[model samples]
Target: MSGAVQAGYAPPTGPDQPTSGRRWVRWLVAATVLWAVLLAVLTWFSIRDDPPTVREQRSLAEAGPVTDRAVGELLAAAGDGGAARLLPDVLRTGCRITPMEDGAALTRGVEVLLPGDDARGLLQRVADRLPASWRAGVETTGDGPVLRADAGEFVAVEGHATGADRVRFTAATGCRPVGDGYRPLAGGGGPETDQATALLRAWGGPAGQVDHVAAACPGGATARTARAESAPAADRPSLADALAAARGGAVGVRATPEVYAWRAAGTSVVAERVDDRIRVTVTTGCDA
Candidate 1:
């Protein structure tokens, strides 16, 4: 028989050759997939300047993956080392702080009270005054961050006769809530007292009728940038409009920019003009 009759038969490819080629292709695809996954993870977790303490964590979110130790550290960063003195709740339950992976956090918070004032002052001011035991449970998550203080909690201070109701007063400047139950925020050298005589008559003074004053001086915070203060207006503009425009969050009504008198949910916010500075006074109790 002739040995040259194999024209229709296809030559077999070497087993090693086919196997090596398949392996190389599979490896290439896997590498590509892994690279894509890594990129996505990095982008999601790219929160800059991780907050160092519980107080700092509050400035971020309220239901995320923050650790207690990290929250404490961020709060410390904002200068809340003595925050428990004012907040009071932290002493009992400590706080949690999670960093934001997305970049929207800077814009979502309460409006910065003044163009000159920003997050830094607000955090520092709030952090410093928080009662050592004042901090409440903290939470941070995909939505945002929240540091619950005992502002709304009825607590007896040394001087007040009636009592005090500290509230969640997130403001622009660093001054605290003062007056009947909030705080006395004085800018450009003003009186550090509340003018609610009716409430006072019903209540009393800080030592007598007053309860506890609330302020925010959260530590480890970067100060807000300063911008030119808005000119004073005889009739305060619509706070709803202003709030809609301002980038920061709930600035203390006592903030300096322009005394903006307005109302939110039936709450009266008074705006006062002092020389070139504008101060807004609000009966702050913003939990909403």
Candidate 2:
């Protein structure tokens, strides 16, 4: 009862202080925002520096040289006696890179005519001759024996028997965006061109268009191949007789009603009966 108004002491007051929980919440929000920003920056740098995928590394233009190199390697593995020729379809502009999708692809291939009854044995021999780094191996498939290997730099190589007398090997790039397209090697005809023309004339067929493909060989040399196919002629002469006459009566490595193949003077000649048309192909520079 101190009647003189003993004033109850009022506590000194300053700015309002937040509760510990509130302070913790504010700090946590700030830290979280900072971490998000840092993560975003790192992700941007990583994406900018690295390629998205393997297919993006080379466009169609760059793929040509890779394919050519693969073809050269395959031809070498086949040995000098194997009569080989570049596939005519490689010259076409609309060649597909993948069958599953619509995109441009690069393919360089050679068809080697080897006279043998055991097609699988031939593939095994070729596979064995390839570089060990290629990891070449032959496997039995439903169709026949197939050779598969990596040709380095993302090029896939595949080979299969076309028949008992022929084997087709192809180096291809999977589907890719067409950049600048492909440009075939340009050059004049060589001795192979003359042989092709002579064979066509002897077969009583019209002259065919000639195309060339070349690859850089070791020691700064270049191996060039010239190819020509005769137009379909119904009244053509017997393939064996015509081939014999054109090749100076030399017996063919493979002589059947469907195919006739021979090698002479560093060139390979093949005549295949395609849908009743004798498609003659002459290729040179196998040894080169």
Candidate 3:
């Protein structure tokens, strides 16, 4: 027997399980390809590359999104008929940069701007880029598209008619200046009107039972009080200067509540009658 024992060292046998190794490699590659395709499809849908979410945070009172809000703010800050014309633009079309118009901005694809962006060109752009749907107060037109998206805010006091012969409702709102603009005003006839309570009282009147309508304005007597009821619809600042003015009471200064009581019940619109008065309740806002 040899005094020194020989130590046996096995030679390197590359990949004893070559087949298994290859299969694993193949699976890994296949998985990678599948993942790539899946990723591509998901990416396409996720990033449409269209309008850039606007990032336009409007400073609203409490309401989420609306049109009249913008009109009210625009008008309030820009001084009547100022941002009123930008209703469709700020509310629907979105904002854009464009040329200059006589009074407003003529930007492209531009919907609205804070009081700061109220340059001639900017306002023109806003006024130009607007949705023709609810633009220009088409609801007032005798024959036109009457949308019923939360019609609760349209109820009115004084019988919910324009007069003894003509029936119609008033559009009121409340708003506050915040963020880069105003928040969408609360939706309603007027907080003071309590149209919802009035309407709920009218219950089912069998269409045509009443043939008159009026606003919560009450012949515009309580002008200030009435203003305290309805909220601004869509909030869009026309000129930054104007918004600043409003904030400083130079342009407009209005405060409103956090939640209009009538809105909490989930009753957008209600039909009712109280004593000799016929009224309709609607979700509304108070001008702060």
Candidate 4:
């Protein structure tokens, strides 16, 4: 009777007293789990839109060199022609990136003035000459035959006929961030300058404001092109006759009333009449 409590009396310490502590511990564990899950979700959202790698995040300025090299490769592939005009400005304007959630892209190109009307044949030749790694191939589209390939480093190359006498080749870089501003590299005229000058004098007279663009060739050499325009001389012979005479019976690559293309001393020379003025272009270091 001394140890036994009465019916209405009970001990203060019992199994139920420990339940509050356990409930507090459970609440703490749930709070920690929720916090961890929230942090993980936030981290995933922050990175979901980022580029997969740094290579894809290049800016226009950063990708300029790659684009220029690609241009060179295109020119080299089509170098058999008489003249090539680098379209750096077109690339700059076409690839100008605008701010967006998905970034932007870049592209560069060149125009080769080809003689003869066999545009498809010329494209085939260019495709065959492209680097084996490029996997160059020709596809006939509704417009015409097109040459498409990859220039490595995620750059793409394409060549298509723009006119009966012009074929354009372009290199493109896929989507990227709009990085720093782009400035074209300054290039000096090579020996081609003198060749262009001579052709200009033969075709017209003195040229005004000659422009030049240079590219790297396959053998660590530099390919240079010089362009100029001047008023046709009234006393000079016709472009075809003049170019024919200048060629010295070596056979002209192209001859027409408005345009003439020929090779002189390892350089390609092209003279074409634009309105009343004749434009002369000379290219060197891409003969091979």
- Which candidate number has the best TM-score? 2
Residue pairs clashing in model 2 are none
Give TM per candidate: 0.21, 0.74, 0.22, 0.71
Candidates sorted on TM-score, descending: 2, 4, 3, 1
- Alpha carbon lDDT at 151, candidate 3: 15
- Predicted candidate 3 versus true structure: per-residue lDDT over 1-288, tens digit per residue: 756645795444466635677889999999999999999998787666543232222223222233233233222222221111111122212223223311111110101112232233333332333333323221323542222212122211110122212222222222222233423322224452443333322232222222211112112211111111111223322223222221232222111121111122211222222333333323221122
Compared with the true structure, the alpha-carbon lDDT of candidate 1 equals 0.31
Which is the winner by lDDT between candidate 1 and candidate 2?
Answer: 2
Where model 2 places Cα greater than 4 Å from the true spot, the runs are 1-53, 89-103, 218-221, 249-251
lDDT of 1 by residue, 1-288 (tens): 876648798766786557677889999999999999999887666545444223332332232112222223333333311111112122111222224221111100122232232333444454444556645434443433344443212221111001111112221111112212211222111121242222222211121222222222234221111112233344544434344333134333343243343333312334334553343332322221
- lDDT string, candidate 2, 82-184, tens digits: 6777763353345455565445767788778886666677688879987798899999899989999987767799999887677899988766656777665
Q: Candidate 3: which stretches are off by over 4 Å?
A: 1-14, 20-25, 28-30, 33-48, 52-288
> After superposing candidate 4, which stretches have Cα over 4 Å from the reference?
1-56, 81-88, 91-107, 174-186, 231-237, 249-251, 264-266
Better of 2 and 4 by TM-score: 2
lDDT scores in order: 0.31, 0.71, 0.27, 0.71
List, in order, the clash count of every candidate structure.
105, 0, 73, 1
**RMSD of each candidate relative to the true structure:** 18.3, 7.3, 20.5, 7.9
TM-score of 4: 0.71
Q: How does candidate 2 score on lDDT?
A: 0.71
lDDT of 1 at 13: 73
